[model samples]
Target: MEYLKRFLKSIGWIARGVDLLVAPLTIISGLSFRAMKFIGVKKFPINNSLFHKIGFFPIVNHYYEPQFDFKGYSQKIRHFEGIDFNAEAQLTLLHSFEYKQELDALPNVKSDGGGYFFNNGSFESGDAECYFSLIRKFKPKKIIEVGSGYSTLMAVEAIKLNRMEGEENMCTITCIEPYEMQWLSDIEVELLTQKVEDADLGLFEKLEAGDILFIDSSHIIRPEGDVLFEIFEILPRLRSGVLIHFHDIFTPLNYPEKWLKEEFRMWNEQYLLEAFLSHNAKFEVVLALSYLTIYHKQEVCDTFPVYAKDAGKTLGSFWIRRL
Candidate 1:
């Protein structure tokens, strides 16, 4: 009987063209369970464990809309004891640096609904701003970013800010953009137009204690090449003091019922992190604020604040550093 109701409710959501078909099923199940109380059915007869494995539809329906929430933040993360990463402080680092002049110089698009958003390819304003914040805070001697886009510009601006402040380091930014987004080349960073795995990592020979490595490339190479190499192969080449950042560390809304799908294998950012954790190495999460995670060497993790703040935002990035 419960399955019949769930199936009918799922059809309703499916008929409505909603992305989360299971949402209606969960809602109907919850309501039916309550009504059963009057009829004296003390226990929920259906095996709902399977539905729970499908995705986060029930939580979204019962809680807030598909927006920022702690449920999203706490979903797939593995937290350790220490000072949580402070999202506000990290955001301040981005805000403190001057980017308005550069952002204003770029082209803008008037919104059909109301205000204007920039034409930069697929960059979320807050996300890009937070990336810039990391650059300002780390003040790394070298920044090697995979899958370059608007982040290249943020790195450039951060370096420019460092120079303006006379920080003495004079950071070098290198972008490995496989698609060769032409606009990114216009920036001041050293742009590599090849896939990340193919890029010459000879730059690592000169990598210093404060260098940073950012990974946001395709999870798996299309016809050939494995993206995991970016972590397994390239990471060993990097020295101990360097910081490693992984973007998109949470399951997407449309995640399939089975976790082992090829799409999940290729694009699910959490897979790579979990795989890395399985390896016998010391990697510490320094900052897990919003969707951005920054990690340093195990010894250095103790130095960072464990407190993370984003008010209420989640995009699922994680930080892991080799010890």
Candidate 2:
């Protein structure tokens, strides 16, 4: 309490007119120092991982990143372990506010008379914010999102916000969601209010070149888990420059549970990443928050192996172990 009071007092002093003259300059100086330090810390860019169209923001999700020198930060990250706020803490209060902003903008349309929420299946406010911001930053001509709920609607919310702010030059977005629970009619209703047209039905099966994908679906199947990606094997058709996103890559929503123990297994990002590398490479984890994984295929490899049956199409699965 005393430390908080002191911090608050310090903030008040910073806000006061007496300090106001020096505050902005001092703040700028502090930011400059931090920027220098961040650059100084092993200055490794994701040049190798960036060839792919994927765009990730690691600072937002606070997910475990193999980079950021985990061994060094492990002590620091664990130092304030129990505190609500840590230097490593990714999402900010601003993220929560953004989520509410998305929620508030949504229209209450009912296909079956219940209040319906719309968003890309990524339902968390912060996760949605992370995705939407990446979309703006990446400016992908083709985009893909994996999991969604009302959060996909939040993306549409972001589109509305972008148009209101006038970003006509931004790239087109296509989100692949397997669950048909939301029903196209409700989605159409929601899009109608936003001046956004209906979603493309071909989103799940295939996409032409210059597209990106979000893999928020599932690594495993469950009664509760509707979308299954492990068995789906849908990564081949995406073009070389496609941006791929994976949600829940760091965390599990009660998987390996009583109901789905037979169907569940531990997931390793390394395995999945290596698998992705079979076809594409050059990547970096931009957002470490919410177990987020974003990668852009720098170039589609020649070894993506054409299936025996359909010589024109790629094989079903590319395993990290086999290749």
Candidate 3:
């Protein structure tokens, strides 16, 4: 009986290894066909150069102000210590993460309404910068990302840079998406075209501590409880020192004034982390930057103060750690 059990476990591992090897190629093949249909021809050439030049001239003054929340931004949330909110500090941090150069080179995607889209879909410039910085800092061995978009590209770039810099560990990525995007076909990430809650997380059984788990898929379609439940399912399987990033935490329900567009108002999605924190006392906030919040399993041990604009104002990102 013992031999039979061990043999069955070995078979499972072998099957997963085969999946890891072939999934990316299969996904890329399907995505290539899809891309031919959707992105083969452009309706109009998106002139990002002209638009970016205009972006230099601030047309709206209110954009510089701090965003307001339902608690009026004075809710006194706990934040990481020693964050400098000055312009110089912001520039320095962006430079440290190589985000400034990347942002400058990004192309602008034009929507049907004649508006420009940056950082793929959903993620803003701030979000991209933060994710890049985190990837560079931690060098997570396994990245389990639940969403497929520009962030996928950014993560791949970060991993490649890490390898170039002589990081001996090879980082592998697994992206879970119900609907795959064509641009991601260029990368070698394992693509799972299924709901995150339904996908087989046993693939992560080999991931040790300090791996990254990023969640940024559906915002409104699933109930908040369902989302939290899925998180609960995955959390216990992870190592304690692993980093988990959750996107769209700063939703309209909590922070109303921080919204850049009217579409955000209709998102009507709640941050599941808030509820997760309320019930479970295991994780702590590493940082909360504009729609993105990072967390980990451990006591807080950093002196970097969270950089907020002022009283009744929110910073683009802030860090919180577990107690």
The superposed Cα distance between candidate 3 and the true structure at residue 248, in angstroms, equals 0.9
Q: How far out, in Å, is residue 179 in model 3?
A: 0.9
Better of 1 and 3 by TM-score: 1
lDDT string, candidate 2, 1-323, tens digits: 55876886787845767576888887886665456445652353453254233442222112442222222222111111221211122233123223333434444343454333432223433344445555444344444455445545545555555565566634444444545544534553222111011234355335433344555445534433323232223444343444455544432122213222343244344234434443333332333432211111111111111111123211111111110
Candidate 1 weakest lDDT stretch, 10 residues: 299-308
In model 1, where do residues sit more than 4 Å from their true spots?
1-121, 221-226, 251-266, 278-281, 290-313
The alpha-carbon deviation from the true structure for residue 153 of candidate 3, after best TM-score superposition, in angstroms, is: 0.5
- List, residue by residue over 45-82, the lDDT tens digit for candidate 1: 44344444553222233233322232333224345233
TM-score for candidate 1, please give it: 0.54
Cα RMSD (angstroms) for every candidate in the order listed:
13.0, 22.2, 20.6
Per lDDT, the best of the predicted structures is 1
TM-score of 2: 0.38
Give TM per candidate. 0.54, 0.38, 0.53
